[model samples]
Target: MNEVKASMAGSVWKIVAKEGEQVKSGEDVAILESMKMEIPIPSEADGTVKELKVAEGDFVNEGDVIAIIE
Candidate 1:
């Protein structure tokens, strides 16, 4: 399994990939809003998204697990 982690502390702005969705490496899985900027969290592995650990508007810190892929 691979964990998709947050790149910075922020509120989740949007989820681009859903559970059970296939994703490739470098694909944006979620977007985060911080300091008026939208930062994208990309998946580092190519696989199906197994779980989402956060929802839109949820606050997350850097290195927090956003999703699990396998």
Candidate 2:
């Protein structure tokens, strides 16, 4: 399993995938809002989305695991 982590402190703006969903590397998995900017979080590897550690509007810190892929 691989952990998809947040790159910086931000609020989750959109969840582009859900549990059990298959994601490819470089595909946007979620969108985050930080410093008035919208950043897309991409999948680190091609795998099924095993879990989401945060939700929309949730605040996350840098290096925090945002999702698990397996």
Candidate 3:
């Protein structure tokens, strides 16, 4: 299993990948809102989304695990 981590602190804006969805490396899985900007969170590896650790509007810090990929 691989963990997808947040690159910066922000509120989750949207989740683009769903559980059991297959994702490629560098694919945007979620979007984060911070400082009036939208930051896209990308997957680090090619795999299926195993779990989402957060939901829309949830706050997250840098390095926080956002999703589990396998």
Q: Whole-model Cα lDDT per candidate? A: 0.98, 0.92, 0.97
Q: Over the stretch 1-70, how does candidate 2's per-residue lDDT look in tens digits?
A: 9898888999999999999999999888889999999999999899999999999999999988889999
The TM-score measured for candidate 3 stands at 0.98
Instruction: For model 3, name the residue pairs that clash.
Output: none
lDDT of 3 by residue, 44-67 (tens): 999999999999999999999999
TM-score of each: 0.98, 0.96, 0.98
- Winner of 1 and 2 under lDDT: 1
1-70 in candidate 1: lDDT tens per residue?
A: 9999998999999999999999999999999999999999999999999999999999999999999999
Model 1 CA lDDT for position 28: 97
In order of listing, the candidates' clash counts read 0, 0, 0
Task: Give the total clashing residue pairs for model 1.
Answer: 0
